[model samples]
Target chain A: MKKLKLTIAVTGLNNTDNPGPGIPVIRGIRESQEIESRIIGLAYENLEPGIYMPLMIDKTYMIPYPSSGTDAYMERIEEINQKDPIDLIIPNLDAELYTFMKAEPRLRELGIKTFLPTMEQFEERHKANLVAYGKKYDIKVPKSSTITSHNDIRKIKNDFDYPVLVKGKFYDAYIAYNEDQVTNHYNKISAKWGLPIIIQEFVKGTEVNVVALGDGLGNTIAAVPMRKLFITDKGKAWSGITLNDEEMIRITNDLIAETKWRGGMELEMIKTNKNDYYMIEINPRIPAWVYLAVGAGQNIPEALVKLAMGEHVAPYHDYQVGKMFIRYSMDMLGDIQEFEQLSIFGEIEQSQLHYPNTQKI
Target chain B: MKLKKNIAVSENGFLFDPNSGESYSLNKTGQLIVKLISEGKSEAEIIENIMEKYDVESNALQRYLDDFIMMLQQMNLLQKEED
Candidate 1:
């Protein structure tokens, strides 16, 4: 084997952890030789010829820090294609995924391969349209509405209470208890971010997130169900446990089938007291916690990466079930301050961890 | 902050939102924040506690917290009443 030379266009080099959790799927695939990874973040420099660094595989790569818009963004992908053949262009962050999806046709014409759902299906899955999807699927999703003004949120607050949530169509979600709090949050977020916003009903229930890797043809190849064993201040799943969630598993299959969905997709669902899992929102791009799925067993990142490189991967395989993950760094203090955070997940009967292993921690 | 909430967060740091009835994975910093938040620590309070104890900058930590805290508010994890 010539060691399949595959190039991954990632968000950025931003971490010190050898194979940080952000893109663990890629790490899992390159397990033997550590495939080549080129990261482009909010601060990549254009001067350096993004060759593989010494820390990374020998293949050289560029780190184009600030990817501006369609033109410059497309240029980076195009440049790679012009040089050595680029294998896969995986958009990890929300902004990049949205932009890449919008400019998909152009990128394809230029001979760059990528994996993502169509723009129509993509729009249907965002937080802004979650309610509409609930209605479409006849599943009890949250009462979702767009917030163009303070008055829009007031309508929900007056009827509801302080436990209202404001969600970004992209990669952000905020839980505000009062009308004033939401207004302040909306102003701060709207003026500086990428897209519009959506406000959701505060349903009291259990939160479950399901991730599935689908072939571009609407066929789901693999699925992973996890419970948040730990979380960040912003409600990010800090640590989690993989489990055999039948209902969640069914909801996922049912969702993509209804949408005739394709490409890789992730769903955020909240099951209420009645045990009804109300579909919350969707992230079309790769979720940051993908490492857990890889660590558990199924290496979707490698599969997706291989697929992008036009490789014929094997049929889907079930990953390591019941695995748990914990992120490091300063923010981890939030996990400590908030002990009840991981108390929600009652399903995980077993777990798995990286590095120092769970025995010591 | 009591451990009475439905969300099952593990010791090694796994958070399950039994409220939403869904499970998720987190990193170490994320584990700490969720643990603290679940323990009922306020945002400023969490920030103050974390800053004094860690090597990360305050602004960066706050920025990273921007999303999860908002999620806490949205999911009712932060509570509707102001402390």
Candidate 2:
């Protein structure tokens, strides 16, 4: 069998305690038998550990944050593409998806392909619009209201109970037992992620998550449900196990069919003792724990690349049940020159370190 | 009273339910009851096996066995009649 050789660029390389999806996604792509992948790591910070990992990234380039606006972001991408000619780019961060989606057309013109949700799909799943989205799609969701100011925090008591969830637009969620706690979390989260903060009805249940990929024409390419076995202080899954939940899969498939959702998505849901599943949040991109889906059976990043290139890919039907993933941290030693190179030159080729004869990018 | 066909109870008292992908560590008595249940022992047989090995009275052992079976049912480690 002939392998497709493609150069793919991916973002969200920060593999810290609160990891990103980049390294694991890269691992999935590298393990593909159908494609021979050349990975280019796109990092927003100089210290993103994926840049320094040996034999993983072909080259690493520092990119401007999405908050710097589209022009700066695209210009940096264009410069990187000029050197490496990225066939496809996968933007993994939730905060960066909007910028990438907005620049999709320009990226297409630059001969780079991306499989991402359309602007309508993205907007409909925003944290602030989840209630309306649930109603529109006929999915059960916790009652939530978006508030822009501190004064609106007082009104929360009238709408929700004492133990409500105080959440930010992009990230950060706190279970506030009283109005004072709501005000405190609101200030902290708003100051970081900005308003309007969302006040959501807290539901008591076991949290379950599903990571799935969909073709724009309403086909589910892959879906894997998992229950977190252990959680970190940051609320990220420290360990998790794959589950056999037919209802969760049905909900995912129906939602994809109804929305014609494109690209990878993570559904955060709460399953109550009464066996009701309530939609909590929908992340618009592949999650950090995507490798668990790959480990179980479905290689989502590999399939996603195929879909982006307009290949006719079939949906995966089965994955190994009882598969578990436990995350751990390891420290690697690197010379100061490697850090200095990326910090000063904005790019570093890992191959250039070992194979001095290799051409520098 | 049958344990799920796929449920695995290791000798070290670790119980794994493949259907739910949930595992639990059982104490010695819990392990003994689950082992007997997996062997297709009836409720009365489980009580007899426990009373023979342990120093507890039959009535007290019966109550503990009932409670243990309920826990197993709640955890979905026991196979339903349909299965």
Candidate 3:
């Protein structure tokens, strides 16, 4: 088969202490033997390591933060489209997805394609609504509450035991051993990520995450489950090993078919000591650990791109289990001039800069 | 004051502490500090070297170095003073 040539754009390139999925997603895309792709990086911050890896990203443009509103966001993308006429965009950030999903219609009209969950599918699966979502889907989920006020913190003692999880609407989670810890986390998380903090029952179990892709028509194209071997203080997976769990695959397929979900999603689950799996949280897009899935013999990002381009894709049946992904950060050296170019002009082409190959150290 | 004896560091900043069975990656600056510490350089000497090369102030370098050493201790990468 002749390799299909494509120009693809991706976001969520922040590979800092709290890494994003862009580099891993790009790695997955690049690993596709059937597809030859020119990658464009959409970065929100100037210092995102993906912007400096000229070998991986042919071009990079700084997009406005999601808080800039969808209009400004769309305008920047529109200008980029005029220059490059993007074939498809895979937005990897949780915060920027609302804008991209809302702009789907206009984007399609402009000949830009994206595979994403419907707004309804996206919202219903939010952490704030996870309890109802699990109920509707007939999945076991930990009891949780979404409270906007500190007064509600006291009421948690009535239903939940000590050591509940205090979580922000979008990010950050802390285990509070008592009411004071709950209140502390509530204040800290709410201040950083905004109101309506989520208080969830702490499920005692091993944490497992599944990275899956859906065809948007009740079909799961790919699913890979992994267990974190080592975790950083920030709760990021520093090292993880893939698992060959039939139950995990079954749950993923069931959830995808039930939701008729589209695009990439990460299911954060807890497998209790008794072996019952409880759904913890759902991230709407591909996770930062997506490269692990790719290495496990499922090129999910490639399949997702094909689905977005309206190509018929067969669901993957088997993958190598026990593949381990150990994430190790390395400094990507870049010239001050490159940072200046990206920050000042909001765009730069790799061909314009004569940079040496990006090394791991 | 010193990196653990079994710590193996690569040129590209990959650090493996055989004692903890954990691996870590550092930036260029972090790699330099770890390397210097392993070579028996004092905190003050490390600060002076970084300040001379990185165009940073002495106070800021000292503070960041202090924090870095604290993290190294937390990760069990630093050796005990008696060891």
Can you list the residue pairs that collide in candidate 2?
none
Candidate 3 lDDT, A162-279, residue by residue in tens: 7789999998999999898998898899889899899999999889889999999999999988888889999999998777677989999999999999999999999875669999
Listed per candidate, the RMSD to the true structure in angstroms reads 16.8, 2.8, 14.2
lDDT of 2 at A241: 94
Query: Where does model 3 exceed 4 Å of error?
Result: A353-361, B1-83
Off by over 4 Å in 1: A1-4, A12-22, A32-67, A155-161, A309-317, A330-361, B1-83
- Clash count for each candidate, listed in order shown: 86, 0, 1
The DockQ values of the predictions, listed in order, are 0.06, 0.58, 0.02
Q: How do all models score by TM-score?
A: 0.66, 0.93, 0.80
- Candidate 1, TM-score vs. the true structure? 0.66
Compared with the true structure, the alpha-carbon lDDT of candidate 1 equals: 0.62
